[model samples]
Target: MNTLRSLTLAVSATLLGACTTLAPDYLRPDAPVASAWPGQTEAVAAPVAVADISWRDYFADARLRELIGIALENNRDLRVAALNIEKAQAQYRIQRADQFPSVALSGGQSAQRLPGDLTSSGESTISRQYSTTVGISAWELDFFGRVRSLRDQALETYLATEEARRSAQISLVAEVANAWLTLAADRELRDLARETWQTQQKSVDLTRRSFEAGAVSALDVRQAQSAMERARADAAQYASQVAKDENALAVLTGGQVPARLLPEKLIDAVTALAELPSGIPSEVLVRRPDVLQAERTLRAANANIGAARAAFFPSISLTATAGTASATLDGLFQAGSGTWTFVPQLTLPIFNAGALSASLDVAKVQREIQVAEYEKAIQSAFREVADALAERANLGEQLDARRNLVEASAESYRLSDARYRNGIDSYLVLLDAQRSRYAAEQELIAARLSEAGNRVALYKVMGGGWQ
Candidate 1:
């Protein structure tokens, strides 16, 4: 009993001493990106970081907020991401369990018949035996921290999966917002086309009347009819685009969108997406879910190297049982029937055809790959933000210029129409002015849509919508 007690204490001490991991200390790789965004003149202080802001607060429209909420609940990709996290968690748990011994209780009975020549007493005999044991079978002791390192790797993998889910959520929210805005923009364009068609039809009717009365040439009536037909074609095209946009939004949201929640025009949607703050590149990129996921994956690879290193050392395992045995079932638990076993195994790598060394090399190479991938993720994130910022810097001025063009073209059309009515200008001048005004109106709608879409892009790249 004293020998058994000392042996148990010694094993416990050895296990406690093996707490440290063989993996190298983790150090985060430097971010491979520029310090500042291109064309950034100065640092801008923002009241709130993009990551700190919730999607609900970022979008001002109540209807848009509701739609995002519904999409969050129904998006299939998000559900898959969530399931992946669960699977990773289970895998981590399984790995962690390897660090502990698995104890089991077993009971059995056996009987054997012997012939007279084979029996010790030289007589035919029947033998019966009964036994019960509680034991841990072939449990690795983790003397070299191999099991610990594997558990750490699994933990990092689970964390990476969680970040992946966060990334999917961010993408889903941004996609829904962009799709909603696109539908609104298409609807606005469709309405503009319809309005232009109606106005052009009125012009065609007036020109035909003048031609019949000998006040205008037949060419003028044909020109007006041609303009009206162009508007009719645009109207049909825009109507089709609007329907396609609706279908896209329905697929993104995972179901048909409520009519009341749908956007009516770009003018309304322009106010739906709020402005995002330009945070420092390093701080913002680190907060991004995709970037964080990459870093976690790198950490997991680092842990794998430790496990590989541990594999080059000796491993120890133990298979132990404590039980009672007797010739009869009733005597199985008698004092004299008590029996015990303790088998310890030690394995040192003597020769393996270099497989162990090759495995360690592979782990090191994989860690290098993860480091590169981590840096790449940061670079990609930086580029996305920079692109969005560059667009945002120009979008305001572009929108203003488009509005001015629309105003100027509308005035030009009004003046030319008055001149043609008073016989001061020809119908050709009036026709050109009408065409310019219609084009300017359409361009203005496009500008508004561009500005709104740019804001959505900024929100997504800045990692604002996931919250």
Candidate 2:
């Protein structure tokens, strides 16, 4: 018992001494972009961190929030991402188990018959044995930290998978919101087109009456008819577009879009998507899911390098069994039949045709690749946020200009219509004014849609709504 105790103490000491890891310590890579976001000025007020904002608070529309909830619950891609996390967790658990011994209960009985020539007796002999044991199989002792390094790698990989699930969730929310906005925009366009068609129809009727009274040429009547037909075609086209938009929204939501949730018009829809604060600190990019995932992958690759380095050192393994054995089943558990066995092994790679060296080289290169990928993710995120900021800054001015243009065009059409009624201008002048007014109306709607969509883009690129 004294010898066994001394041996166990020595083993424990060796294990503690050998727990050193060869993996390089992890340090977060520097941001690959500017310290402050582009266009960020000293006058700009510091804003709340996007990561701290919940999706519910970011999206003010209750209906949109409900739709997003359904998408989160039922989106197939998000489901797959979640399942991947579970699988990664299981994989990590399996790898971690290697760092410790696994004991199993085993039992066996054997009987054999020997020929007369092969046996001590000149007749056939029978041999029988019975044994029961609870012991560990060949378990690597982790004397070089190989098993521990592998377990660390598995842990990092699991963390990376969890970040990937978060990325999927962020993307799903953005998609659902965009899809909802698209339906609203298309519905607005359809309404605008139908209204234009009605106004043009009245113009055509007046032109036909003038022609019948011999007050205008048939050409005037044909011009009005042409404008009316174009409006009718547009109305039909927008009707189709609206239906397609609804179908797209339904597909995004993974079910029917609730009728009550549908925005009645573009103006109403735009009001629902409130502007997000844009003066966020650049450090928030570090918390972006994709960036975090990339960093975790880099850490995992770094851990793998440690495993590869540990491969150069000798490996130690142990196998042991303690049980009772007897020639007959009746005596298997007898005190006199007690038995024990232990085997320890050491493996040194004296020659491997450069396999170990090659493995280490591969691991180092993989870590470098992951480092580059992590930087690239940060750069891409920076660009996304920058683009959104730039758009957000200018979209309001553009919308204002478009609204002014629409008003001016409306006044021009009204004056042209009055002139034509008094025979002070030709039908051609009235037709041109009508075309201008129709175009300005369409542009105004487009401008409004763009302004609204920019808000969603800002929320998405800033990594908002995934708290």
Give the Å error, residue 390, model 1: 0.9
Question: What lDDT score belongs to each candidate, Candidate 1 first?
Answer: 0.88, 0.84
Tens digit of lDDT per residue, candidate 1, span 43-147? 565667888778887787888889999999988889999999999999999999998888899999999999999988999999899999887888888877899
Clashes of each: 0, 0
What TM-scores do the predictions have?
0.96, 0.94
lDDT of 2 by residue, 373-433 (tens): 9999999998998888888889889889999999999999999989999999999999999
TM-score of 2: 0.94
Model 2's number of clashes is: 0
Native RMSD of candidate 2 (Å)? 2.2
lDDT computed for candidate 1: 0.88
Look at candidate 2 and give me any clashing residue pairs.
none
RMSD to the hidden true structure, all candidates? 1.8, 2.2
